[model samples]
Target: MSIAQLTVVGGGLVGAAIAYGAARSGISVRVLDQGDAAFRASRGNFGLVWVSSKGNKMPRYARWSREAVTIWPELHKELLELTGVDTGLHQPGGFWLGFSEQDVEARADLLKRINCEVGGEIPFKMMEPSELKQFLPGLGSAVVGGSFCALDGHANPLMLLRALHAGLKEKGAETISGVDVTEIRRDPDTTQFQIIGRDGQRWKSDRLVLAAGLGNANLAPQVGLEVPITTTRGQILITERLKPFLDFPTNKVRQTREGSVQIGSTSEDVGFNDGTTTDKIEWLARRAVATFPALANARLVRAWGALRPLTADGYPVYQGSTSCPGAFVATCHSGVTLAAIHAFVLAPWMAGLTCAPPDIECFLGDRFRDPNASFSHDH
Candidate 1:
């Protein structure tokens, strides 16, 4: 099975990772990106490579996320060697701070259930305020308790994107920017795919991948796949550079490598309006200060909003088009957490270098075909 040419739509974390992986496998790959005009979630991410407390009801997703973080070191090293860019990965475990005992108890129960479901593969510790204070010395009195997962960590998302793009170039993958793909058609004589752009440019390839984030909702149906993905606006705030204080990333707050604290994010169901609001910003700031009182005096540097491409259940959608062979669609909210898997696992399978990842069937879009199917985006 020779995949002569492959094209990935979108240049965000998901597409870039797939393109890099395919190119690294010695397949000719091209990436068509809509450029800055696109709602690039890769730009505005929380940068967490987290695992615990994810996939509360789905064990398959839990396992997939665990595998992604486990192989992150390999991906990090390979990208550094190939592109000379360090991604600033730190996996010293992370915290999920809670204000009230009820919140902490609920979190603990959820983690316990997830661990039981995954057969104890996910390890976590439920810590009280005293125990948590040892790990995070600056915790405010309002912090009752929290959960810690050794598998949880974070990185510089911008650097990771840069490294992936750099690795793509180093591996000889071609990237076409400013291309708004409008149509996808199959050639009757050759069964090849022709991706048509709005600017009258067309590219043909043996395989086509729709990893276009929010764009997948529109593009997937064109190739016989349905991705019921919606957009949620999440606003993030950045504090000025301070002395190194935080050692691990949390669900609500994290200090970057340059010593700036990143506080974020409210999940709002605003349709395509990725704009920040004062209420959300103030809420995030107050929460961050409560998490670490030191942040109360810190200066806020910036704030912005980005849309998360999420399915009804907040799990990923990875499936090949049965109606149109050689066509695939991939969309997920955890783009930062799953970049490694996208590159190393999904990429090879898509490129025909290996079989699909074990248990990938759980992520098929057909799961949503059931009229009685219920879903949640809590993750």
Candidate 2:
């Protein structure tokens, strides 16, 4: 009933993971979620805990993603044991199919560069279509080559979100839904952050975190931090339950445990328009069938779009506010892949229980302050 030690401004996967982690460490936590009205990427992602071809521009992120997948099983086991919710984590590696020889060669070069930069921590193998067909028996003739990473895997993203929420409850954290937080101000005398909802209700916390997806762009400046969050609308499609064919997840398609094929997605800079089009849906279906011919016969059951939160460079922005001492901002597109590190490593630092991660400086939003710096949000 009293002021929480830490209050998270988004109860999606990223915020829930942080709140659950801090709560497990004995910190009283409160989560404010926008509920169903928000553009929920947590439920709409491709469910890949992918690590290949990531962080080619930033070595720290490459290492961070690798670290995340390495410790994912730990969080998975802990959440399942405590909440009795299965996360459906299957980590038998994954493939990145390419339609042309040029793209496949480029992928190999990027993977090798990332691996060499990160001390060979991310081991990858380049495979021709014939070799790749061994792992993916349904590989279409259009596929020329691909790359495989042992650390890449997939999970049921909705179940992961459910399990994290359940774990938050089990750890004694408060989660408030349908709360459109409109304003935030720090009381200098009390040294507490005051959060005001749209309905004039309020709550205070000693520490505050902004992980509200695209909402972070507006909220961070209120706490004396400049975080520029960009949105890319990604459309996805799902097919009716069919016999299992996809044994491994790919960049474009993956079969869930319930036998439904999740086909996705197109990244468009449409600026907050989270709507799917017939063209993209048809394109996705064609690609899915080209990768796995059996999907052509599977009827599409659903289609939708969600916005992905990204920074200038398509990496993460994990920075604390210098003006508002206890305020922090976190945003990224790789929420599913980075969930474990965000909970285990990032939360402790935000809760003041430990120091920041060694490579945290590279992810700071301050990097965008340079007027001449050019960035690519292609991750």
Candidate 3:
């Protein structure tokens, strides 16, 4: 059989990362980027490689994130090898601050559930405010207690996106922008995907990757896939360049590689509204300042908002349809957290080079297929 051409239906983090990995493996690939107006989370992410407290509700997701983080080093090396770009990845450790006793209790319970599901492979600890001081030398007395997870880390998301694009190009993948894909149709008798755009361009390929983020919901059904993905709004605030006081990232705040403080991420259930709000930013600033009083002096520089492409149950969805064998759908909120796995593991699977690991079936879109199943609420 002749080699097949592949078309990845989005140019954001997930699609770009997967395309880059596939290209590196010597597959011919093209990425369709829906121009700037699309909800591009790759440009708007917290940039943390987080692994703790992900899957209390979904163990498969928790495992996938852990697996993703474990492979990040090699992914970083691959990016550097191709483009000489360092993604500013740091994995020393990270924290979760709780100013109230109830906050501490909530996290304890959450972790307890997560641990019960994992059978103890994942480690976490509850730290007293005093105990936290030693590990985190920068002190803000208001933090009553907190949790620590060694698996969490940080990286420059923009740099990673740039590097992935460059590396994919170096590996001979074609990336086209300003193309609004209006339709994707599989060939009637072949394992090929015929991609059609609003601008009247036609693209034919043997495989398709549905990674259009929140837009996946709109594009998936045409190809026999259920991209039952939702959007959660998160806004990030940037502060003026500051002294490097934060060694690790917490949910509320962290210091960037460029010395700016990135504080944010309001997880509002409001659907598809990716706009920054004062109330959310104020809440984030108060929490950050409470965690590190020194940050009170930092000047606010900028703020922006993006929607997280979340599955209803808050895990990633990766599946290749039996209805359309060469068509695949991939969606996730942890784009930064799972970039490594997408590039290394998921990409190879889509290329027919590797089988889904033992737990992969649980993530397939078919699980949500039953219209009357209790889980059907997920759609």
Candidate 4:
């Protein structure tokens, strides 16, 4: 087999970010993207460059997400420099709104456990309806309370994707859209990898990075790795451009730089369904209006549904295979939040260099207890 250079098999945020970073290092890369048919989490995203209330069950993941937040500004500048695309990156702050006292208390307790490890950032004052006015003027009085964290922000996710794609090419990465990778064959003894496309075009690379979003689980077993991932459908509602009244991003709504409000608050366990529903869109619009009355008259410009590439444990999975020496897999829920870390940190590690800045073993997909734990093998 010819000595492989570098071949990445996905073009969504996760794969595109890592591939762009690695290619920026001057390695040759081929990104086989499925294009429109692929469940594009990037399109349906709320576009919050957020970092609060993540990794509740695992401190390691919390620290990782926070690290990415700090690294994001530099990345935005780099992307703009490379592609002349300003990503509209903003970091005034973010909010988690609540309609009742119990909701505030519950989220507070959850943050309490996760924030202790990150230190000081986890706990914030419960935003009484009055205090909420300081952060969110014109907030509907019906809003019971909220939580504010300084460690959060928002950006145009599509612009981020556009910047990443252009920057990757500027860095000399080959991004092939609509090409589906059918197989990843690895020589058990030689550690050689050949990534075959559905059209029978084969790519031989000494190193392979599988960041294929929900498509990783099926690809991992061919290289003796595990990617325990499942799909959770999330929907979003976008309101017509209006004067911005909301300053910070909430889980249910965020105002984009273009002055359009983005509303999202639905998570369903439905499998492989990526179509938005009228009922859900209406429900989210109503919730957003309840929190911020300014949104009541705002006409909905768009709505969408897409699968969140989620793990059962709700933490990222980063691992290399014992059976396939040169192949590695990386997947996570917070792709936008963690794009910088994937570029600066995980890219280097996947390049086979030793000495990571922190302990990353916890993210290995193999942590699942079941020896035969099944995932989306056919996906």
Task: Kindly indicate the candidate among 1 and 3 with the higher TM-score.
Answer: 1
Tell me how candidate 2 scores on lDDT.
0.90
Tens-digit per-residue lDDT, 103-162, candidate 3: 899998988788779887668999998899887777688888888889889999989988
What CA RMSD would candidate 2 show?
Answer: 1.7
Q: Candidate 2, residues 82-177: lDDT per residue as tens digits?
A: 999998899999999999989998998999899999999999999998898888988899899999999999988889999999999998899999
Residue 302 error, candidate 1, Å: 0.4
Which model scores highest in lDDT? 1
Best of the two (2, 3) by lDDT: 2
Candidate 4 local lDDT, 1-379, one digit each (tens): 2223777778899988888877777667777788887888887777887767777667777788888888899999999988999888888778888888888899788777778877865445557788879888888877888888787898888888889999988988887788778799886666678889888888778888888888987888888887778898889888889886777887678888789988885777789999888888878888888888878788988888989788777788888777787788888877788888888788767766544557788887777858675433111
TM-score of each: 0.98, 0.98, 0.95, 0.94
Best by TM-score: 1
Q: What pairs collide in candidate 3?
A: none
lDDT of 1 at 40: 87
1-379 in candidate 1: lDDT tens per residue? 7689999999999999999989998999999999999998966799999998888878999999999999998999999998899998999999998988889889989999999999999999999889988888798998888899999899888899899999999988899899999899988689899999998899999999999999999899999997999988989999999999889898889989999999977889999999889999999999999889989899998999998899998889999988888899999998889999999999988887888888889999998889998877794
Q: RMSD in angstroms, candidate 1?
A: 0.9
- TM-score comparison, 2 vs 3, better candidate: 2
For candidate 4, give the lDDT.
0.80
